[model samples]
Structure formats: C-alpha cells, structure tokens
Target: MATFTPPPTDTMRAKLLLAAREEFAAVGITGARIERIAASSSSNKAQIFHYFGSKEGLFDALYAQTLAETLALVPLDAEDLPEYAGRLHDAAVQRPWAQRLVTWYRLERGDAAPMEAVVASNAEAVAEIERAQRAGVLPRTLRPAVLLGLVVHLAAFWSETSPEFDTLVTAMMPARRRQVVVDAVAALVRR
Candidate 1:
C-alpha cells in the first residue's frame, strides 16, 4: 500500500500470491510446491517463474506483504497495551493464515531474513513504550522490549497453543479468548 512501491498490480501475480499465501501457511516454505501453487492459481510453473523467479522469491514477497498489512492494520498502542493485545488477537482470529505464516517465517527464515518492517516497527513500539513509562503512563517494572514481547505473545495464546491445550480451551468462545489476552496484558502492565 505504499505510494512509492505498491504491490504488483498484475492480476495473475495477485492470484498467485493469494494462492501461495495459503499454500505456504499450510505447508511452509520447504513443503510448498510450485506445481500445486500453479494449479490452485490457474497458472502454470512458467508464469510463476516469470513473475517471482523462484519459490523462495514468491514466499518472501507474500510474507513481506502479510507483515506490511499487519503493521498498517495494527499500529502499536504503547499506552494501552491491553487493548493493543486484544486487537492483535482479533486480527489473528480474522486472518488465521497470518499467524500461521508468521510461524512458518520464523521456522524457515530464522535470523537469515531480517525484515526491515519488523525491525523498524519493534524499534518504534519500544520507543513509544519507553516514553510512556517515563511519563508514568506505563509501569517501569519491565524493560520496554520485554514488555512489548510479553504483550505480543499473550495475544497469540489461542493461535500458538498445543493441540492438547487447544482441546482444553475449545469452550472458551472468541469473546472470552480476547478478554483473556487483554486482562493478562493489563495484569502485566499493572506490575
């Protein structure tokens, strides 16, 4: 959505990215196959190659877009970490693939791919939290980055849980799940 360099406007490329998002999230980068992706998008391997050059290239583009959308949609609110965490939970629920893609990104890319968007976003959020702490808006108990990391992880309680944990919390409806994230962050911030 940047004016300087927006996503490719080609319809075929868009379709491929859409199809690739699901494929990568479901199977991850190593498991994703160009043939399946092409079939899903009604495109062939040649077209995908022409557009993205390779599987890794396609995955990188989609992941970058996914992260950019998250940043744009969920700007951090350091002063209100509880509500910010709740919003993040809502976003994960709305776009399940987003969370899955993040997991895949970490497992595969690791530190090899340091996304500029994520680094800048984390720096900005940490700065905001520090400012808020100095102003007495947020507690000074935890380091800004640790507090931010805690809040972010708490928001993904439902998304990152084990299968056993998932079964145990099956009855915790969406509203309650969101409230749990917000309340947990609130408790952390209170300290």
Candidate 2:
C-alpha cells in the first residue's frame, strides 16, 4: 500500500523532532499543533505526515527517543545503589519533561496501543530489577515489577508534587543528610 519515497534530509528530520518535542512538552499531545510544529521546524505539514504518518506515529517515535535517553542514564552495572539514586534524582530535576511526556502518554489521547509501547519501552528497567533480585540486591518479598514501579513512581512523585523537591530531595544534599536519607530508604525497603 506504500510507495517508495526519498527520506527527508537528516537536518530537516532533526528540526522536526526538536520542534515536536518542544510543542509536546509545552502543550502535551492533545494540545500540540502540527502546523506550528511544521512552521517552527521549517518543514511543511505534508512532510511531517509523510515522515510520521500521523500525530500518533510522531508521538510513538518521540516516546521511543525519550525512553532511550532515560535508559542511557541508568548504568547497567549499578554497583552503588545510593549513587544510582543520586543520578536518578539529578535527572528527574534536570529533565522533568521526560516524566511529564510519559504521563501524557499514559493519559492516552487516542493513540493506538500506547500502553503496549510503554510496557515494551520499560523492558530494560524490568531486566535491571530482575538482575537485582537474583543478586539479592532487591528485596525478595517484593516482585521485580513492583519494586521497579516503586522506584520510578517515588522519583516521579517527589519531582512533581514536592515543593522542596529540587533543592532538597534531588540536589546533592550535604554528605551527612544524603547518608541519613539513603540509609532510611534502605531500611524501609528492606523492612
């Protein structure tokens, strides 16, 4: 049903991606403007449709890119749990858009199979939890999925609602306080 066509130039594609990201970040998917995205990207609306098929298609591509970026920040060999938590905290503060985009996707403004895509994107995180479980790093009483959900949700919750989130929870707290909270969480998780 499809015919072959020349691919859009890399520069053009990059601009469109960047523009789409900004639009989605500002107004969310339901409110995003395809025409404005095209204008800002210096491409035509037709070009966007040609490349992405539809707004949903464009969203899928953008969501995949965002997930990849998030996964990259998570080190595969998480030797130091507190250090990894610190990294996650920093990322949440610096890239709040990342979680907000996912939240928008979860709200599901008519995208096909959006839930499936989100689960698929989370495969790497699930795998990390499994590895932690086998190594006894994660509590045996908790399912890997549950534990992983807790980690992500906890970070997201603090990032979104806590007035003191960035300055207190996410920032590199003074060394003494960092240990106090890290130990507190370790105790709670182990309980």
Model 2 TM-score is 0.76
Predicted structure 1, TM vs. truth: 0.89
Instruction: Give the alpha carbon lDDT tens digit for every residue of 28-105 in model 1.
Output: 999999999999998899988988899988988898889789878888888899999999999999999999998998
Report lDDT (CA) for all predictions: 0.90, 0.69
Q: Name the runs in model 2 displaced over 4 angstroms.
A: 1-8, 76-79, 109-111, 114-118, 162-185
- How high is each candidate's TM-score? 0.89, 0.76
Inter-residue clash pairs, candidate 2? none
Task: Specify the highest-lDDT model's number.
Answer: 1
| Best TM-score among the predictions, by candidate number | 1
